[model samples]
Structure formats: C-alpha cells, structure tokens
Target chain A: SAVISQKPSRDICQRGTSLTIQCQVDSQVTMMFWYRQQPGQSLTLIATANQGSEATYESGFVIDKFPISRPNLTFSTLTVSNMSPEDSSIYLCSVVGTGPLAGYYNEQFFGPGTRLTVL
Target chain B: SQQGEEDPQALSIQEGENATMNCSYKTSINNLQWYRQNSGRGLVHLILIRSNEREKHSGRLRVTLDTSKKSSSLLITASRAADTASYFCATQNQGGSEKLVFGKGTKLTVNP
Candidate 1:
C-alpha cells in the first residue's frame, strides 16, 4: 500500500481561472494516473503521467485543457486550465506499484482527491 | 469507454447484516479489483480476484469471479455503520498496458 497525498483538498475558483493540483507519493511508483469524478457518476481517466515523458490523455481530454507535469517518479502536477462550471468535480491521482511482473498484479492506490468547484 | 457495470445502484442494509454487490465486465481481464470510498474521501483498495482464481477473501470481505460469465461479486459479512461507502469494481484489460476501467459504484449505506 502507498501513502498518497493531494494538495488543495477543496478549492473554489471563478470561471475561466485555472487550478493546479499536486500529488505526492510516499514511494516511487511506475505509473501515475489522473481521473475525474463528476457528481453522482463514475470516474473517467483523464491521463497517465509518466516521469520524464509527456502525459497520455484519454479521449475527450487534451493537454491544452489539462496540462500534466511529472517531474520525477514520486511527484506530479495536473492543472485544470480554463475552468468551467462543468469542470467542477473531484480530481484524483492514482498509482500502480512496481510489481513482480511488468504488468501483473497492478493494484491502484488513490490519493485523497482535490475537489474543485467552479463558480 | 467503461468496461465494468455494477448492479444495484444503491443499497441500504442493517448493521450486522450482509451486503452484496455484483459487477459485469465487457472483456476478459487479468484481474478484477474491488474498491471502497467513504464519503468525501479517496478510494481504498478492498480486494482483488484474478481471472484464474475463483474467489479471494480479506478480513470480512469476500470476492468471487466468474471468467466464463465475465462477472464478479463482492460480499461483506457483518456489516457495520462504518462500512457505509461506495463500492466499485475495476477490471485490468488483458494484454495492453495495465490500465483499469472502473464501473459506476454501488452506494452502500449500513444503518446502525
């Protein structure tokens, strides 16, 4: 199990503004992911942040809207650009530990989310 | 696109009773994992059941997987008020990079 923490647990921002959330992990992890959870809905993967590489955004999400920077193996930042009311939701960061196999037994550990409310 | 779908959007159960939730996925997976999220908190990993294994248990939680049917179920015995939370099932797609696709969760409310 990993101890993950996210900055700005809750924030209220005006429309058109941007909010950057930080995620820190206690230990080094192989893969880090970002997800969005709309109220009363399932989570949607936003992107996968790979250290020293560009983040891979999922369909319907782009780097322009959500820029991600993974400086090292234990830290990453996600900036929600040009916030809108529709963008208000909980953003969570998840990581998969280095397992015995390259891709086997991949269990995700999530950070305490950052709740952003756009007014 | 979502791969898993959980049954019973919501459930209310009395403390000391058992709570059960089911999940169905679209494709074969390496493993299926269950997660629990308390209100206003991050998701906590509960248990994981591999495709080759039929069942797995941890503490009071039990998970069973049926690869032939592409479905899984989670059972919580002796529920308590603290057990009130949202439960989700995630499937690890076979082959590709190990990315997990999650399903809409089951909101379980254990009333004391």
Candidate 2:
C-alpha cells in the first residue's frame, strides 16, 4: 500500500472562488483518480489524471469545471474552478498500488481527502 | 455511469452480530470489491472477489460473488461499534479498464 496525503484538509471558500487540492503519494503509482462525494451521497468519479497527458473525465463532468494536472507519477492536483454551493463536498484522490501484473486486482489507496465548503 | 446498486440503503445491527450487505451490478465485471468509509473520512478497501472466484475471506470480512447473476454480497462477522460506517461495492470490468464504478452504498450502524 502507498501512503497518500492531501493538502488543505479542509477549507471554506466563497462562491465564485477556486480551490486547488493537492495529492501526494510516497511512492510512484501508475494511475491516479479524482472523486467527489456530495453530502450523504456515494462517490462520483471526476477524472483520471495521467502524468504528462490530458485527464479523462466522466460524463456530466467537464475539464472547464474541474481542471486536473498530473506533472509526475507521484503527484496530482485538481482545481475546482468557479466554485458554487453545490461544489461543497469531499474531494478524494486514489492510486493503484504496484502489484503483480501491474493492472490486476491491485487495491486502491486513498488520500485523507480535502473537504471544501462553498458558502 | 453507476454500475452497481447496494440493497438496504441503511442497516442497524447490535454489536457482536453479523452484518450483511448485497450489491447488484448492471454489466459483467472482472471483479467486485467492498470498501468501508467512516464519517468524514476516506474509503478503506475491505475485500475483492474475482469473477472466477466464488468466495473469499479476510479477517472478519467475507465476500461472495455471482458473476452469472451480476451480484455480490459482503458479510462482516462480529460487528462492532467501530464498524458503524458506510459500505460500498465497486466493479471493475474485464476489459482491462482501471476505472472502478461504485454503488450508492449501505450505511451500516452497529449499535453498542
């Protein structure tokens, strides 16, 4: 398993502002993903951040709203641009551990998460 | 798109009892995994059952998968107050897609 950490554990931002959450892993990983969980709801995948490449977003999510950057294999960032009250939720980053087959049933390790409260 | 749906949105059980949660998915998958999440915390991976495997156990956790029916179940034995948290099931397709689609989740509250 990898030790993951996120910066700014919790923050309160005004509407229309932007917040960038950082995820750092102790060891290098092959894939990194971003997810959002609304109040009392299941997690929704926002995008997959790849080093030195563009992010792949899920349906109903766009790059303009959630811009992601993965400059290296061990670090990634997701910026919630132009925040709104609806954007208040828990943002998480997860990475797949280095296991046999490199893409097998390897478990995913998650960061502590960044809690954003848009007022 | 969401691939799995968990039954009994919420469950309340007394400590020392066993807790069971079921998950049903829409499409075929390579494996199904169970995860636990405490309030205001990140999810912790519990167990994973491959499509070819019918049952698997890890400590107090037991997971069973029925690929033919596209469903799975997670059983937590000797539940404790510490087990009061949300449980989710995720599916990974056989197509080698690293992405995992999760279900809504079952909020299990093990009362002390």
Candidate 3:
C-alpha cells in the first residue's frame, strides 16, 4: 500500500479567489488522477494528470478552470481557478497500486481529500 | 451521467450483524471495486472483483460481482461500530483504460 498525503486539508476561500491542492505519494506510480466529490454526491473524475503532458480533462472540466500539474510520478497538483460556490468540493487524488495480480484487479489508493469551501 | 448507482442510500445495522450494499452500473466494465469512506474524508479501498470473477473476500469483507446484470454487492459480516462509514462502488469501464466511475455510495451505520 502507498501512503498518500494532501496539503491544506481544509480551507475556506473567497468565491473569486483560487486555491491549489497538492497530492504527494510515497512511491512512484504509473497513474495519477484527480476527482471531485460534491456535498452528498458521488465522485467525479476531474482529469488524468500526465507526468509531462497537459492533463486530459473530462467533459465539462477545462484546463482553465482546473489546471493540473504532474511534475513527477509521485507528485501532482490541482488548482481550482476563478472559484465559485459550486467549486467547493472535496478534491481527491488517487494512484494505481500493485495489482492485476492473481485476481487481475488493479486497486487505487486515495489521499485524505483537500476540502475547499468557497465563501 | 454517472455510471454506477448504489441502492438504499442509507442503512442502519446492529453491531455484530451483517450489512449489505448493492451497486448497479451501466455499460461493460473490466472490474468493480468497493471502497469505504470515513466521514467525508479519503476513501479506503476494500475489495475488488474482476469481471470474470464472481466473488472475492478480504477479512470480514465479501464482494460479489455479476457482469451479466451489471451489478455488485458488498457484504460485511459481524460488522462493528468502526464499520460505520459510507461504502462506494467504482467501475473501470471497458474500452476506457483507467477511468474509474464511482457511484453515489451507501451510508452504513453500525450501532453498538
């Protein structure tokens, strides 16, 4: 299992301001992804962060609003730009762990989410 | 639209009893995973059941998958108060390499 950590566990930001959340993994991982979970809702993948390439954003999410940085295999950052109340959600990062083994299922380990509250 | 949907939004069970939560997903999936979330914090991966495998177990957790019906279930036997948390089901969609679609999750309350 990999130990993952996020910075600024919880923050309250202004509606027009921006906040950046950082995710760091203990070991090098092949895949790192960003997800958002609104109050009482399920998780929605924001994007897949590539180590050296522009992130592949999911529909309705753009690079301008959610700029992601994958500097290395073990580190990634997600910044919520021009934030609004709707952008207030728990931002989580997950990485694929050792798997697809005997059971042929790859597991993902998530970091303690950075909760952003837009006021 | 979301891919997987969990049933019985909330459930309350007595300690030492069994708790079951079901998830239904649309579309072909390569694998289905169950995760536990404490409060609104990070999610802990519980168990994963492959598309070909019908069931898998880990400790007190048992997960069953039915590719034919696009549904999966998680059963926690003799659950305790520490087991009280939100359980989520995530699916790795077929044709989609690493994208995981997560369902709304079921809140399970185990009372002492």
Model 2 stretches with alpha carbons more than 4 Å out:
A99-104
Q: For model 3 chain A, where is the 10-residue window of minimal lDDT? A: A97-106
Give each model's clash number: 0, 0, 0
Residue-by-residue lDDT tens digits, candidate 3, B1-109: 5897898799998999999999999999888889999999999888878899999999999999989899999999999999999999999988957779998899999
Error of 2 at B103 (Å): 0.4
lDDT of each: 0.90, 0.89, 0.90
Docking class of 3: high
Between prediction 2 and prediction 3, the one with superior DockQ is 3
Q: Candidate 1, residues B67-111: lDDT per residue as tens digits?
A: 999999999999999999999999988887667899999999999
lDDT of 3 at A54: 98
Candidate 1 ranges beyond 4 A from true positions = A99-104
The residue pairs in collision within model 1 are none
Q: Provide the lDDT at A3 for model 2.
A: 79
In order of appearance, the predictions have TM-scores of 0.96, 0.96, 0.96
- Candidate 2 residue-wise lDDT, A1-119, digit = tens: 44789988999999999999999988888989999999998888999998999999999999999999999988999999999999999999998856431335776667888999999
